[model samples]
Target chain A: DTAVSQTPKYLVTQMGNDKSIKCEQNLGHDTMYWYKQDSKKFLKIMFSYNNKELIINETVPNRFSPKSPDKAHLNLHINSLELGDSAVYFCASSADRGDGYTFGSGTRLTVV
Target chain B: AQSVSQHNHHVILSEAASLELGCNYSYGGTVNLFWYVQYPGQHLQLLLKYFSGDPLVKGIKGFEAEFIKSKFSFNLRKPSVQWSDTAEYFCAVSPWANNLFFGTGTRLTVIP
Candidate 1:
């Protein structure tokens, strides 16, 4: 069984549009995170949620938002998508932040 | 804020060759370390982790890492690498139960 899974493995949108990516995990994990991988393969944290509460918000723009309706689901919504926002976004979950994480198959976003 | 540095951006090797990837972190107080691997078109998977045990930790796919507290380093090593082992590796650290800070990834290409 897939421990962590993401929906819409690929997305194509135009500038000024809005998009959302869904993520789920069955590992009974308490924490979920969103990370972005740029063209240079730099993986950086964008947001983190624990038990459906926002905990970490990096220096990301206000256009990006993350919502966790429950412990098992964490979704990312991007508004006013720009060309620079085009990148592969990965969703991950862990029992806790101190433990290792299980990442979902990334969603490749293309903004034109 | 915690940060991780991966010294090698890209590496290439032949099958059966030994491999080593360097990882360094900047954090004070207690910290947890981890290594994650992502194969082509696949999600990231945990390779190894270090959390206040023996400094050396082993993970799946014949990968191992040693945590040196003095130098604040967790280096991944493989005695022999196969073509299938080629992937992008990430180093991460979390000082506590909040968020994980990841390093710039190292892309490995093991040519057969």
Candidate 2:
């Protein structure tokens, strides 16, 4: 079974449209995260939730919001996507603060 | 702010070549280090991690990493690499939080 799974493996949208990416993890982890990987392959953490509570929120713009309904799911919604929003969004989960995360196959978001 | 730095952005080698990728972090406190690999069209998978106890940690697929506290570095190494080892490797560090600070990945091309 895939420990971490993300929906919409690829997404292409217009500049003013909004989109959402869903993520789920069956690892029973307590912490879930959303990461953005740019064309240069630089991965940056955007948000993190611990047991459905927001714990880490980086300097990401308000256009991007992460919602975790429970410990198993974390979803990202982007409002009025722009050209700069074109990047791979990855979902990850970890059992604890000291454990390495299990990452899902990234969702490639391209804003035209 | 905590940051992770990967020295090598791209590397190419023939089969059976020894491999080493340098990773450095800018955090003085206790931290967790990890090396994650992303194969072509695949999700990111944990290669190795260092939390505490023995500084050297072994991981899947013949991968290993050493944590040097004095240098604030955790470098991944493999004695012999195969063609299947071609992937993008990411170094990440977490200091007292669930969020990871990732470095720009290193793309490895192992020629057959």
Candidate 3:
């Protein structure tokens, strides 16, 4: 079974458009996270949710928001996307803090 | 701020060549180290991880990593690589939770 999965493998949109990426995990993990991988392939954490509670919110713009309706699903929403928002977004899950991180197939966002 | 560092940005090797990728982190507290691999058109998968005890850890697909506490280094190695092993490798460090700080990934290509 696929442990973690994300929808919309590739996304191409106008600079000012809005978009959303959905992620789901069957691993029954409590903690889910969102990461952004830039052109340089540097991965940075954006947000983390544990059991429907927001645990970590990094130094990211307010344009990016994450929502977790439950423990098994986490989604990312971007509003008024800019050219700089073009990058790969990855969704990951873990049973607990720093334990067995599993990443989903990344969503490549292209703002043209 | 906690950060992970990967020395090699790109690596090219012929088939049957040994492989090594270096990773370092800047953190004084206990840490969990991980090596994740992303194959072409696939999600990032766990290659190996070191949480505690026994610094040397072996992962699937003939991959292994050794954690050096004093140097804060976790280097990955594979005895012989095949053409199919061509992928991007990322090194990550987490100090206290599942939220990770990743280094810029290393894109490795093995020529058959």
Q: Write the per-residue lDDT of candidate 1 for residues A47-79, one digit (tens) a residue.
A: 989988888998999999998889999999999
DockQ-based ranking: 2, 3, 1
How good is the docking of model 1, by CAPRI class? medium
Runs off by more than 4 Å, candidate 2: none
Which pairs clash inside model 1? none
Model 3 DockQ vs. reference: 0.77
TM-score of predicted structure 1: 0.95
Q: How do all models score by TM-score?
A: 0.95, 0.95, 0.95
Evaluated on the second chain alone, the candidates' TM-scores are 0.96, 0.96, 0.96
Error of 2 at A54 (Å): 1.4
Give the per-residue lDDT digits (tens) of candidate 3, residues B19-89: 99999999889988889998876778899899888999999899999999899899999999999999999
lDDT by residue (tens digit), candidate 1, B1-112:
5579999999999999999999999899899888989888888888988888799899898999999999999999999999999999999888787678889999999999
lDDT of 3 at A68: 90
Segments of candidate 3 deviating more than 4 angstroms: none
Model 2: per-residue Cα lDDT at residue A95? 79
DockQ of each: 0.76, 0.78, 0.77
